[model samples]
Target: LAKTTQPISMDSYEGQEVNITCSHNNIATNDYITWYQQFPSQGPRFIIQGYKTKVTNEVASLFIPADRKSSTLSLPRVSLSDTAVYYCLVGEVGDMRFGAGTRLTVKP
Candidate 1:
């Protein structure tokens, strides 16, 4: 499994776009980049996943460079309700693990 690095906390105002980057220096070819978002007292929910290039959905977009050493999660026009902890994970099926996530605070 590849270790992940992300900010301990981040602050944003309502209606602002936010981008969180995670680094995985030892990422392997079989490893995929996955992100999850968790609200207070709730389980984390999958946000996005990617092997390389970009992947997008209704909630967010994931960007992975060719080297696959790092990735970014992009949220558009976040609201106060969007405040949550974001986790970045890198691994293959049986080796997946979650790291200390980035806390995002969205203010009104």
Candidate 2:
């Protein structure tokens, strides 16, 4: 996966919105940006993905700018249960690396 970086934590109250951003300037053309959500002691779950522009699913929305160097994951009306680690990975699913992820904190 293309290398990426994001904030270590974000504070949010219950019923509020949260947005996490990631940066991967070295991303390749064939690489796709994918975001994952992981609660403590659990594996990361696929949230959203996009090559460019915006892609929205039932869980979250992914927005990738035209440059493709950065992406954002937007969660609407978050709750305390939503507090979890969010990861941004770039590349195919099979091509992944083990790295430290950003730990998100949601407040109630």
> For each candidate, what is the lDDT?
0.91, 0.84
Off by over 4 Å in 1: none
Instruction: List model 1 lDDT by residue over 1-108, tens digit each.
Output: 578999999999999999999999999878888899999999999999999999999999998988888899999999999999999998875776777799999999
Clashes of 2: 0
Please list all clashing residue pairs in model 1, or write none if there are none.
Answer: none
Model 1 RMSD, rounded to 1 decimal = 1.0
Candidate 2: C-alpha RMSD to true structure equals 1.4
lDDT of 2 by residue, 1-108 (tens): 478888877788888778889999999998988888888898888888899999999989988999999999999998788888888998876675535667777776
